[model samples]
Target: MEESKSGTVRAVDRALDILLCFTDTTDLGLTEIAEKTGLHKSTVFRLLASLEAKGFVTRDSSTEKYKLGFRIWELSVNLSQGDDPATILLPEMERLRDILGETISLYIRDGSERIRIQAVQSKHSIRRVAPIGARLPLYVGASSKVLIAFADMNTQENMINDWKEFIDISAYKDQMAGIRKVGYATSVEEREPGVAAVSAPVFNRSHQLVAALSVSGPLNRLTLENMKDHAGLIIESANRMGNMLR
Candidate 1:
């Protein structure tokens, strides 16, 4: 029974190896997969057949090459939705909101925009409010800037080029350096007039930037001095969320 279990484990490993071989390359033929995985062509073919049956892979009718299928993407989306940072960090967000007496939000990068995945509204009679799933430009706002500040250089350059009319690319780049140094970002009326925010990046287990945590309120309440004072608290809360995720 132990020998049988060991064989099954090996088979599972080989199957995963076959799936992972498509990570970089777009498509692969039977011989290519076999070579990459160091598995026999017959074994590769068998594995491909099994994966194909499960909708994890597909073969092109014309090219006879295999590529990951829509089902794989569907599963990935489901997994990501299930383990969303917004759901996992709600307690931290609530704590930050309580501490700062401002609206707290969690945002994730979405192409050229950042989407508010979760939010805790402030109790004050007059407070800034952004609905959950609100999409905002990547080149503006504290949360947005935090996302851009940690993004790859190529992504930053592209975004700057895209928003050059609204922002000075060189100046933005300089600010990004400071934000990285301080481990957080602040914006005063950058996106919405009379509003100010302080934001920090949140990382996953792999240390990849996954989201931004932000506290926002009216300019009168979230003054520059107040933002500076609360920056450390926001950063600490963000770090706590990152640790939990990791």
Candidate 2:
């Protein structure tokens, strides 16, 4: 019985690793999956077959690559159905959107990245639009930085280590300190050229950082001075949402 349980656990771990290998990309061929998971092609194939059978993965016939299936989305939706932050924050986001005439978004931490759970588009003909369900790196963008700044020290260190290849981790110390001191953050074309954003952290009933609320748009409309001017409003909105959650 012990041996059977151990084997089952290992298989589950392998399966989860396979699923995670799809994080940075839209699809992966068998060989790519095997390389990423460090499993033999045959072993990876077997795992993929099992996952495919359970609707956890799907294969594209034309490209012969696998991608996450609808079942995974269904599970995520079900898990979030009860206390999804987006449902609670949309009204505040809309209000901010109207007040600033820019795109507003709600983001939650997911590993070393932040995922957009809600968004309201800007009214401008040219604007930044980060769609719901989009995943962005933790080391870039104002929303992502707000989440990272409020995360625990261990998480902060891990993210900085993971992203050291692309960013100077040392440069973030003062930025994060300022965010904590002022309760907000800002970015100008850090993640995408010609875009700028301001963000504030939101907390839950227990005073835990749960999400970030951000206002973003084209650089022309979201210039440094304008973003600084709107920072207080964004922080106020985030505080109100945090109170509502509590």
Best candidate (score: lDDT): 2
lDDT of 2 by residue, 102-188 (tens): 999999998877899899998888888777888888888999889989989898888888876788778887778888998889999
- After superposition, candidate 2 runs with Cα above 4 Å error: 1-8, 21-27, 60-63, 110-112, 131-135, 151-172
Overall lDDT per candidate, in order of appearance: 0.88, 0.88
Show model 1 residue runs off by greater than 4 Å. Answer: 1-82
The residue pairs found clashing in candidate 2 are none
- The alpha-carbon deviation from the true structure for residue 94 of candidate 1, after best TM-score superposition, in angstroms, is 0.8
Task: State the lDDT of candidate 1 residue by residue for 1-246, as single tens digits.
Answer: 222355666767888899989755779999999999999999899989999999999999899999998888888666754466777899888888887889999999889988898999999999988688677888888898899899888987888789978988889899999999999999988988899999999987778898999999899999899999998888889889998884
Q: What is the lDDT of residue 38 in candidate 1?
A: 93
Residue 12, model 2: lDDT of 79
Query: Each model's RMSD to truth, in Å?
Result: 12.3, 3.8
